[model samples]
Target: MPRWFYQLASPRWSYEIMGKLLPWFAIVTAALLVSGIVWALAFAPSDYQQGNSFRIIYIHVPSAILAQSCYMLMAIAGAIGLIWKMKVADMVAKSSAPIGATMALLALVTGAIWGKPTWGSWWVWDARLTSMLILLFLYLGVIALNSAIESEATAAQATAVLALVGLVNIPIIKYSVEWWNTLHQPATFTLTERPAMPAEMWVPLLVMVIGFYCFFAVSLMLRTRNEILHRERRARWVRELIEKQ
Candidate 1:
């Protein structure tokens, strides 16, 4: 393993690195979200079809994207913890659940809001939507499993296995629109293809997506730092750091 990878396993080192990175992530998140929202709501042209209702995409799309990304990170982190016995990786996986759940919920709610106008109904059993709902449930399940287990290590392992099992849902969610007849529209952005929307609209959406990732980083770091301190309370470095503060 690389030196930095080994260093990351140290709770104190992880905590310190997060502390240094937090402020920067926080600043970028704030700036991007604010600018993106303003540009999206105030400046972007209304959709010819949906009019103002399209503005909700600024939130819904980003939240939905972040929710999926968070799950992948959580699952990968859990796998690392399971394979290497890295406490920091476990902390990251644990910290990720609530944030991912919240984002998924936000996506669902905003999707509903976006749906009412676009689909004539606030809710639908569209494949993409249903799979996204299942993703949210998966996050909740991980959280419940983690809380139910009394032993930290046992809890981490249990949740890791569950997360790994749940990984199957992600691709289903991503490809659902294309795989089935669904009310939900195709993805606005894809790596290999240009967005169908005009530059003015997609640019702000891109900014929001980047901002959402930054916000997730800030949230995860804050939660993981807290988990590190709590899990390492008995360590000499943790105790000394606490004393210094």
Candidate 2:
């Protein structure tokens, strides 16, 4: 391979490496989520207005963050596969769709729950919320197309195209609330601006965000490893791997 990372284009190499790394990711993901959830649910202070209902932020915020991030991750990996014909990249893109969809669903559901208390409604057709809904549909479309196609290469190509096209929605999703006046509040967290909440509140949100990222990594690694094994099953290395198992 010309580059260190490109060598992992090989499905066999990807599988072995993923197998080795999965346990560590799983452990760390579990630890972070457990600690974060406990701290968020029990120790975090209630909002002055939203009351205990605001505690849903732990799940809602993390899932919302992961939902967007995973889609970008899939789109990037899809781009790599499209440009380089890398089987591992395609596998990563394929494996990431369902996970991303799950996170999106969680975000919507948790958002609705949090919304019911704050907004007096379970659903709203606001800009940010609508764009997030589209994101979920895009994830589902990718997964469905991947499953429907008979040929792996064709499936990858088709899904990659969809991912690339769907990327247009990412910016829209991000800026929807800004572009339109909506019930959804402006971002609570921002890179340049100081957070609106006290450190005690936002700190737990940050922790949950990090923990959710670890959980996503753990989930993606497991799914990617499974995909690699399936795609490489006919290879000599994979045969040897199965024999060892």
Candidate 3:
């Protein structure tokens, strides 16, 4: 709404502001992650049902949430680039692919780790697991497409189309537990109902989720800034900005 806020929509200004903000976000993320890990691993009481295995939920859930969110955010960026011819938006979408893919990989691996003793299997074809695997494929597809193409613009366009098409999977992943019988448990954290875990258990999970989001934000900004510089290397404004820094 404000003039200054709108100015941030500009890639040059966004990079500058985000560069200044990155250290603070990094610090906060480190603090939150450390506190959350300590609280979840030690201070929080073990689950009566899963014992120490439930502690894996903190990392798994948060990474899964971030993985999904980052995909959606990247899709939105792709849409903006395609619709408005925004170079910055395309750059952002490009930069976000690896990070989103990493989060998805973490979510899947952590989920598998939590599943082994509880489910008696390392993998499952259940709805949630199946949908998540598809999500990972989508991330890989986007990243691979980005790298395979020669021209950045053409790559961005291809990835944007792929991301837009992949958007259909997001809802499927979110609602898979509700829609079908699955080995995977339903949402542990829900906005509308009381949490399934006790305060001690869920609180650390909430902290970890917040920390994951902050870390994602910081990563996106840093990656996008690098992209902005790489693309804008010939711009006088970029040269001036670099000189000032």
Estimate the TM-score of every prediction: 0.99, 0.97, 0.95
lDDT of 3 by residue, 1-245 (tens): 56874565688888878889999999999999999999999899987878889889999999999999999999999998888777888988998889999999999999999999889899989899888899999999999999899999899999999999999999999999999988888999788999977898899999999999999989989899999899889899989877999
Whole-model lDDT values for every prediction: 0.96, 0.89, 0.91
Candidate 3 residue 222 Cα shift, in angstroms, is: 1.1
Sorted by TM-score (best first), the order is: 1, 2, 3
Residue-wise lDDT of candidate 1 within 1-245, one digit each (tens)? Answer: 89999898989999999999999999999999999999999999999999999999999999999999999999999999999999999999999999999999999999999999899999989999999999999999999999999999999999999999999999999999989999899999988998999999999999999999999999999999999989888999988987998
Residue 188, model 3, lDDT = 90
- What is the overall TM-score of model 1 with all chains considered together? 0.99
Query: Which candidate number has the best TM-score?
Result: 1
lDDT of 2 at 196: 97
Q: Please give the lDDT score for candidate 1.
A: 0.96
Give the candidate number with the greatest lDDT: 1
Arrange candidates, best lDDT first.
1, 3, 2
Q: Candidate 3 has what TM-score?
A: 0.95
TM for candidate 2 is: 0.97
lDDT of 3: 0.91
Candidate 2 lDDT, 125-159, residue by residue in tens: 98989999999999999999998999999999999
